[model samples]
Target chain A: MKLDLYKEHAAEYKAVKKPIFVNAAPAQYLAVDGQGEPGGECFEQCVGALYAMAFTIKMTLKAKGQDYAVSKLEALWYPPDGGADFETAPKSEWRWKLMIRTPDFVGKQDLREAVKALQRRGKNANAGQVTLEKLHEGECVQMLHVGPYEQLCETITAMLAFAEANQRRQHGLHHEVYLSDPRRVPPERLKTLLRQPVRKA
Target chain B: MRDRTRHSYEQRILRVLTHIQQHLDGPLELDALAGLACFSPYHFHRVFTGMIGEGLMEHVRRLRLERAAQRLKQSRRAIADIALEAGYGSHEAFTRAFRERFGAAPSAFRRRHAPLPVPDGRAVHYTPDQVIRFSPKRSSRSMSVAIRTIRPQRVAFVRHVGPYDAVGEAWERLMARAAPMGLLGESCQFIGVCYDDPEITPPERIRYDACIAVSGPIRPRRDLGVQVIAGGDYAVTTHFGPYQRLGRTYARLCGPWAARSGRELRAAPSFEVYLNSPEGTEPGDLLTDIYLPLMPAPGTE
Candidate 1:
């Protein structure tokens, strides 16, 4: 996905802190979680579900002629708490949240309505239940990361370390704005901007 | 004073070049061209050479020969007609110019080159060995757009055959035909859709439409008929420039962007919604919105 328009306007996006709403819809999704030797697929089902919900909301906003500024998307997975029967157990869930800012109130309503519609349609093989939430507005530091999605963890680690050294605490949530959709773009060409909303301690 | 004088000279040279390109088929002389530029014959040669990087005779000869080569590959016009249009008093002179430019005579070149494909459903592959070579750099960021499905459109078009230089006359004819029918309303802008091979169609022979898309019933007229333009998801971009450079913009936005994005290119005819026309604005300052139909990548559905 080569978006000439976005690249041309990237500089404008890096300036200032703007008010934004964060919508996190938990669902079944394919994903890998944790780190190192202990890390494995944490909640694949939940990741798939969240992606479907996010995609649905995106489609609904376009249908209403309301365009939103999508700032970021991030997936968090947590393993099941108790030791239980592995085979018969429901898959541990993951939350895929997308942060978007829109000047139009009608556009936000359109997104809420879309989530309701997805919930009404019922969960299937691809999607799960939908949820929406608003993120508090504040200063956030973001850097454009160019390269493959697999190497994104390194960039995220560097950002976190920078925040820690500067005595800035994580304000709310971790998020990623997809500058390039990897499915259409080559792995080496993918661009995803990592953004962390932060506050002074 | 010097800068102002140089600017005027540059403008005159550009105008002369446009005139020569527009009327390459007819006999053209340096005196006549110098008169158009308002320059004295003695200084005109120097000015033309300095501005255009070629002598007056050499530039005219090159343009005419180039035009003849394009016509031979694109149009079914007789070789003699082409030779005459190229300003050769005899077919033999035209043949010599043609051979000099293409390293082959007119008939032999035509035999070796296939007619450039019309902008029909067939996809034309432009390779490195082809006449034009375009290598574009890929952009980093990709835009996320919500796809919208559009309703089908009904249009009546009058196909204008020949170079875009002569397209203005075809458009005038279309406007005249639409005037009596009250089809020339404020809401409508003249739509020109280019189709066919640029390499094959002599600039005079390229196929275009002097057309307008309408919602109501289309009445019968000369060379006018009801045609359905099926609608789908379209990737649109607006370009501001003279109509001549619109093709280059399309090549950049659609040809390279679509190919790199992995999007499926639909066969629908691309359209230009002429927002500003030569009637209301300067030809160099016109604005046009180009639209190309697109679909999701294969296996995505």
Candidate 2:
């Protein structure tokens, strides 16, 4: 049977109408960082390379009878250097870390070997850029935003207000957990979990 | 930094973490781990700190102590033995380190049988079993438990030996085997008897039996087996989430809740009764009643 992380941790991946606090659990991810807009060439290359490595590792583990469902794509968005804020930062100055969660059984050896194999096949030149890292974003305020990406600020504003009323303040990078693929799901129906790590005021 | 250079650094640090996890009981000199990552000890420490957000030795010490904490709670091993296994030279040294990390002495911690100390939020810790990602303990989750008596049940079951996540095949086979034999009745209760705690037992060695309660005559077949569910006084609770997360409810039911409820645990294996099907219900709405057997009265046996 295939292990589904979303199903295993239903509360963590659930979609919520209003902003709510959650203790986001620790997880391992295959991450690639870049500076650009979401759909830029570098971003696309990194996403493709990350998935290539993910599939390679997944297949290898599946052969060993450790199969799992590939989790959703997620990203951490940061403003460019020099004290620029995300709201006003130019699209070119956006720094993002694209990530896909990997199962615990996937080790550094699996990733290193996957890179070597992909390199040998001359597929995904950016394969080596994908690295394994564990992230623990504890005590976050999150809400499900359903619609176009351009309309996210409205949700963020409402979320910020909710947090302020609850005596919490954002303390980490802007994080997004995509539950639906943009290409597959309609923009009106696309579901994205907007998360912001927060701490008591 | 170039992507290649960044990847190299991240990969080396990951390798070091893996090495540390595999050899926590053995010698974990910074020089040895650095050599494994193909770097000088000096450079390796800085790189590891830069990537993992903790000093290398600090990380190792925390992992060793955390592992010791797990052993303290899960087994009856002597503190000295646990200290030795955690790479501490002496019990005193282990206790001091454990106190600093967990804020309580090892014996006191064991006496209380409290949950492990809150992790440092670094996402790097020690696990006795497989190297899985960390999740917050479900001890704080609210639970409504009821003590009730359950009648013994006769059932047909299919045994499964693997990770709990991979029990679908057994269920599929059981359904197929039971459907044609006129055993799929509206009153039949789908049950699962879990024989091992995944946290304590290795994933591959864990045992589970997918069963369906049957009242009529049934014979043991090649693929299916018949058994009696020895039911008695059970502390029952409803788990309102995905079946994959049933372990959390079990942990709560058996851990703090059981320890405080003043009920002695029985030797019988615990089982679950599905309240609803997962076919159409939302994952969050799926419910399962977990029944943990309790010891009978002194003379009732």
Estimated TM-score per prediction?
Answer: 0.34, 0.41
Q: Which lDDT tens digits does candidate 2 get at residues A122-147?
A: 54578889999998888888899999
Weakest ten-residue segment in model 2 chain B by summed lDDT: B130-139
Candidate No. with top lDDT: 2
The CAPRI classification for model 1 reads as incorrect
After TM-score superposition, the amount by which residue B218's alpha carbon in candidate 1 deviates from its true location, in angstroms, is 1.8
- Over A97-201, each residue of candidate 1 has an lDDT whose tens digit, in order, gives 333322224344544454454444334233323344444435555666778866766776777677777777767556566655443457787766666767776
Q: Candidate 2: lDDT of B183?
A: 50
Model 2's chain B yields a TM-score of 0.57
Q: Model 1 over residues B126-167: C-alpha lDDT tens digits? A: 222333221222334443323445678777778888887677
Q: lDDT by residue for model 2 over B120-149, one digit each (tens)?
A: 664677866646352212245567999998
Whole-model Cα lDDT of every candidate shown, in order:
0.54, 0.76
